[model samples]
Target: AQSVSQHNHHVILSEAASLELGCNYSYGGTVNLFWYVQYPGQHLQLLLKYFSGDPLVKGIKGFEAEFIKSKFSFNLRKPSVQWSDTAEYFCAVIYSSASKIIFGSGTRLSIRP
Candidate 1:
């Protein structure tokens, strides 16, 4: 079965600190990977995504993720953080173009200023 797993249930960071969130997935064939962020009281927004081409993709707000197909890992990273970066991050995988997205347990990031 295809599934997505987020290893970190919660993360705490200080302003200007670096951030990394672990994500892994299980699928047989090619898949689409995505990182979505939901700020408090806001809708989920795409942080980054990988479909094809470059294994490393960059997203909004200085966020980036690397897709390692062999390991089935798509880890998100941020070089620097801010107080407003506090949000819930979700890793998702889609087996096919029309398949439903499987979302991992979200990681809630709290940034202390």
Candidate 2:
């Protein structure tokens, strides 16, 4: 029953607007979490991560997330986004070496200028 799912498949925003995309997983063990963003024709970059320690973590481009162990979720949030933030957001889980990293279907975020 180890699976992760994204609720938001696509999102659109203006010049400055709040953003909140949901990510839920079904793992019952200690695991690493990550959020990756891929720009148009660009490779995937680490946005943030929750390996151990703190439950709240931040990353590049003014993005942050809070890990809720009870809910098995690591939802991403951003206050006031920009046009450059327009890209595909993916939520991934770090599993054992045998299992490759898995990415959500992706949330296409389009920013209107």
Name the regions of candidate 1 deviating beyond 4 angstroms. none
Which TM-score value belongs to model 1?
Answer: 0.96
**Model 2 TM-score?**
0.92
CA shift at 106, candidate 1, in angstroms? 0.4
Cα error, residue 22 of model 1, in Å, equals: 0.6
| Alpha carbon lDDT at 71, candidate 1 | 92
State each model's CA lDDT, in order: 0.94, 0.88
Off by over 4 Å in 2: 96-98
Candidate 2 clashing pairs?
none
- The alpha-carbon lDDT assigned to residue 82 of candidate 2 equals 95
Instruction: Tell me each candidate's TM-score.
Output: 0.96, 0.92
- lDDT tens digits by residue: candidate 1, 45-76: 99899999999999999999999988999999
